[model samples]
Target: MIDFEIPADVAELRDRVRKFVDTEIVPYEKDSRVTAHGPTDELRRELIAKAKAAGLLSVQQRPEGMSHLEQAVIFEAAGWSTLGPVAMNCAAPDEGNMFLLSKVADADQAAEYLDPVVAGTTRSVFAMTEPDGAGSDPSQLSTTAVRDGGTFVINGRKWLITGAVGADTWIIMADVPGEGATLFLCHGDTPGIVIERVMNTMDRNYVEGHCVVRFEDLTLPESSVLGSVGQAFRYAQLRLAPARLTHCMRWLGAASRAQSIAIEHAKTRTSFGKPIGRHQGVGFLLAENEIALQQCRLMIWWACWHLDKGAKARHESSMVKAMVSEELFKVADRCVQVLGGIGISDETPVAAIFTDMRAFRLYDGPTEVHKYAISRQLLRDAAE
Candidate 1:
């Protein structure tokens, strides 16, 4: 009994985003500023300028009353070009940072930190994961922030922190003795923070590549604490569920774009007296991709629907993220296979898309971790 139709306004926005991506963003795929780390700040700014000129930048930041369901429609369109999300200012970890700050930051804090990020004037980082520390299991966080009169002295090293090098805002999670986990919001150049290095990762779609960072004797006033002591985990859930779902939404667009490129290649490339698309091999792969693409889209919509209804959607998002990540990677791989040598080469975006899709499998949370979490929930429910 669920209506599958998108609201007219959402549909129009989605189409506009898609067109902006194809016409304005796609041509920058070969831009020199795009590096192994990610697109340079200069390239990102130019793309943002174009999107802003077209009235297509930061739709997520506007007060247009777009719902979570509406975001699913728009984010997928932005994912068409890897740069599209960057241009639209909806790319993570900035996007997720905006959501977290909006939910928890005070008016003054939001004005100081969140406003610039939402406006695309600056980027932000969520510093959670650490080397040999929190990852699939956030409870293992070892970063420390000890109380010192009216301030907290923080010290820790965090790796895989996206956009940390160029970020202006930082949301750091640390363990406070006897107080559990806490979240801290601080400026990126807060004296004690240091950029260790930018990790060279396979996926280069982000504005700043994954990075290693350290907070050495960083001190901040009590006002730097986000919500409440020991509530970092709760706020993390608030960000992670929706952020994971949005990841699926954006990557779904990349997978779909890959499928489109592969299909066109198949249609034109003739072999064995006819186009290869007429043969079963490439044809069947495209068919499976189409099915997976639709499934990914539907799962995203279903999860977004639950979120819009005020549900946390933790289980729904975990399952959707795990499934969509795997399926989308498969679609990308199939596209590469269909394209033969050109697939692995830079001649087309299929290679980059495939690499990014593969990284998506491990980005938010690895598939095995999600499966383990789902099983534990099932066992816990059964025990009751």
Candidate 2:
């Protein structure tokens, strides 16, 4: 039996995060300068300090005996704040990157890269998704990392990289000599490492800035290798499962906010004599959205709980990603519809939430890809 009840301490943490979001983040959403790429360097630093002061940073690294379900509740609460995830230093791809490094990095490696990240002293980017290929297919990775006398030289271009614009370091994916795939940690200033440009995404609240980066001949010491050589592909797969679930958790919060807005509008805005909410059409759509959100929440919690038990959660995670992405988008789209023209305007967050939900469908392995993966698993199970 699965227990979804969050413990008292975890519940308190969730309240703390929600309070921080209301006080610190909600006010800044309307600021013209805080675009989708997220807050500026100074703003991010300030927010990180504030979040740390509130004991919100690294909330995922629970005590030795804490449950994964507890962590998921806390994460979802942090997601409630528009900038809580990033502010608390628990947002992706950093969250996922940090988790992967902590699992595989040795003492020195952890000190140099992972520790600083957990401390929120620096930002990192995962150079995995490529342009024409390798987005969903790990085997299609085309970047190359050749071993030199005492270093590894990397050459390739990585696109749609979140936090690439101001990343202090990178966990780059590349093909290792004689190995199928590998991960290398390289500093941003390493020679031949170049950030081509920050891509303008629909959602502008992400920090560090998303960009397309080009590495001509970036060189790093052998110490840069993360985990066993050639096992990078396996590590990547491991990281994505939890990371995608986290996205669902956070986006679920955003969708809830949108729903709240729509509900408020429905109650106050009247048409033809009474509140539009009285109309069966608008009321039914709102009902469907509420149902979908609850269902998505349960799926995400299940996946997180499974992970806490040290289970692979391959099939479960894929299902949650596929289902949650679709459901969240529906909620966002309904919010836009309920609000009418005002919903599409920058006057409210509904428009931005809609755009974000669309992009969510693309990132962390698209819905189509997850469906294919889940279907193949079912077939294999049946055959067995």
Task: Tally clashing residue pairs in candidate 1.
Answer: 0
1-384, model 2: which lDDT tens digit per residue?
756677788888778887888788777677655765766766777778988888777777644543557656767777765577878888877888987887888998888888888888888889987897777997888889998899888888889899876677689999986876999887777778788888887766578568898889888888898887898889998888888888888888889889999999999999999999999999998999999999998998888778977998989999999999999999999999999999999778889889878988887889999999999999999999
Per-model CA lDDT versus the true structure = 0.91, 0.84
- Please write out the lDDT profile of model 1 over residues 1-384, one tens digit for every residue: 999998898899899999999999999999989999999988988998998998887788788666888999999999998899999998888888899998999999999999998878889989999898798899999999999999899999999999887788889999988998999989888899999899988899888799999889999999999999999999999999999988998999888899999999999999999999999988999999999999999999999999999999989999999999999999999999999989999999999999988889997789998899889889999999
TM-score of each: 0.99, 0.96
Pairs of residues clashing in candidate 2: 35-204, 36-203, 36-204, 36-205, 36-206, 37-204, 37-206, 38-205, 38-206
Off by over 4 Å in 1: none
At residue 75, what lDDT does model 2 achieve?
73
Deviation of model 2 at 177, angstroms: 2.9
Please estimate how well model 2 matches the true structure, expressed as its whole-model Cα lDDT: 0.84
